[model samples]
Target: MKSTHFLFLLGLLAACNSQPKDKEKETEAKAEQPASHEPTVNCYQYATATDTVRLTLVHVGDNINGMLIYQLKEKDRNVGSINGTMNGDILLADYTFKSEGTQSTRQVAFKKAGNAFIEGYGESAEVNGVEKFKNVDSIVFSSSMKLEEIPCK
Candidate 1:
């Protein structure tokens, strides 16, 4: 009778030890599952008939921060950086840049078109104490002045 009782106790111990293997498998399965999210960064470059522009933007929550380079051919160039918020596929920011040995600030807007950016152009106007383009319309950019996206560094 003592041996029967001992065998029963041994059987209970074996069953308990087997459960850990199943638990380990469950843990491994959870680890194998894909994460709920993946990080991403937006970058682009555009070439026009008279200029080349590049952008490298990092998304911070709903806002964006990055650099902007507008180089002209045989003319003055605007080189500076930008920081602003995005509305849908559009970005409106204040561009503080140097052109022809002078520094000035202006408000500019850009519209995303697939892998390209269509810069908005309009008559000069003052808004919020800064020089900005008013009467924005998509008709401003010609096909030769479109900016195309390039690989990020």
Candidate 2:
């Protein structure tokens, strides 16, 4: 009777261990599957005689992730990554960048026009050490810098 009970306990332990192996295999199979939707990538650039700005945006539904580089004349170049959401024709994001060996974050806004994006500007105040527009609705989207769609390279 004691030997039968010991055998039964051993069988239960084996069953428990085998179940986890099956679950691990199932998890591995799911991990190997490709994503249902691929991210859409778009690049844009605005250039002139003295300054140039390049933007690359990747859209997955309404969420956006992108890289922005500003090479303005007589100014320290700011290279950064932006992650934000697209609300109607407006794109609002927080730009986190490293410039002059220091990292900083600031709020940026843009308006979509045809195949181009116009940078928005407005009164900004420092909030928690991050500069953000006082009122997003009051931002002016008439900046001369208009980033036009360009081929990714």
Candidate 3:
């Protein structure tokens, strides 16, 4: 009876030890599989006589993230990051930026044209210290600040 119990214990230990190897093999198989899609990056810039804005966008599937920099003459430069989603031809995002050593967050919208993106403007109200559009549907996409596609440097 003792010998029988010892054999059962040894078998349990062996079974437990084998489980990890199976898990490792599964992990290896997953590692060998290719990614479904690679992230695509696009850069754009809007320049005028006194202001210049640069935007770099990276898209991974439906998600988007990017950097935005605003350099306007006589105003503090704002450098920030934006993350949001693309709904149809409209891109809605949250812009978090720093200017004059102060941090601010706001919602931004852009309309995609043939080869450029036009910044949208509308009435906004401060909510929880962040500025958001009063009505997203009412936002006007007629700003002259059009960011033209440029090569990523």
Give the per-residue lDDT digits (tens) of candidate 1, residues 1-153: 999999999999999999999999999999999765433567777665666778777666666677788776886777877777777777877777788888778877778888887777667777766787666454265445566777788
> Which stretches in model 1 have alpha-carbon errors above 4 Å?
1-40, 48-50, 135-143
Deviation of model 3 at 46, angstroms: 0.9
Question: What is the Cα-based TM-score of model 1?
Answer: 0.63
Residue 115 shift from truth in candidate 1, angstroms: 1.9
Rank candidates by TM-score, best first.
3, 2, 1
lDDT of 3 at 97: 98
lDDT at 95, model 2: 95
lDDT for every model?
0.75, 0.95, 0.94
Error of 2 at 88 (Å): 0.5
- Per-residue lDDT over 39-84 for candidate 2, one digit per residue giving the tens place of the 0 to 100 score: 9999999999999999999998778999999999999999999999
Q: What lDDT does candidate 3 reach at residue 2?
A: 100
Give the range of the ten consecutive residues with the poorest summed lDDT in model 2: 34-43
Poorest stretch of ten by lDDT in candidate 3? 34-43
Question: What's the lDDT for residue 141 in model 1?
Answer: 51
The lDDT of model 2 is: 0.95
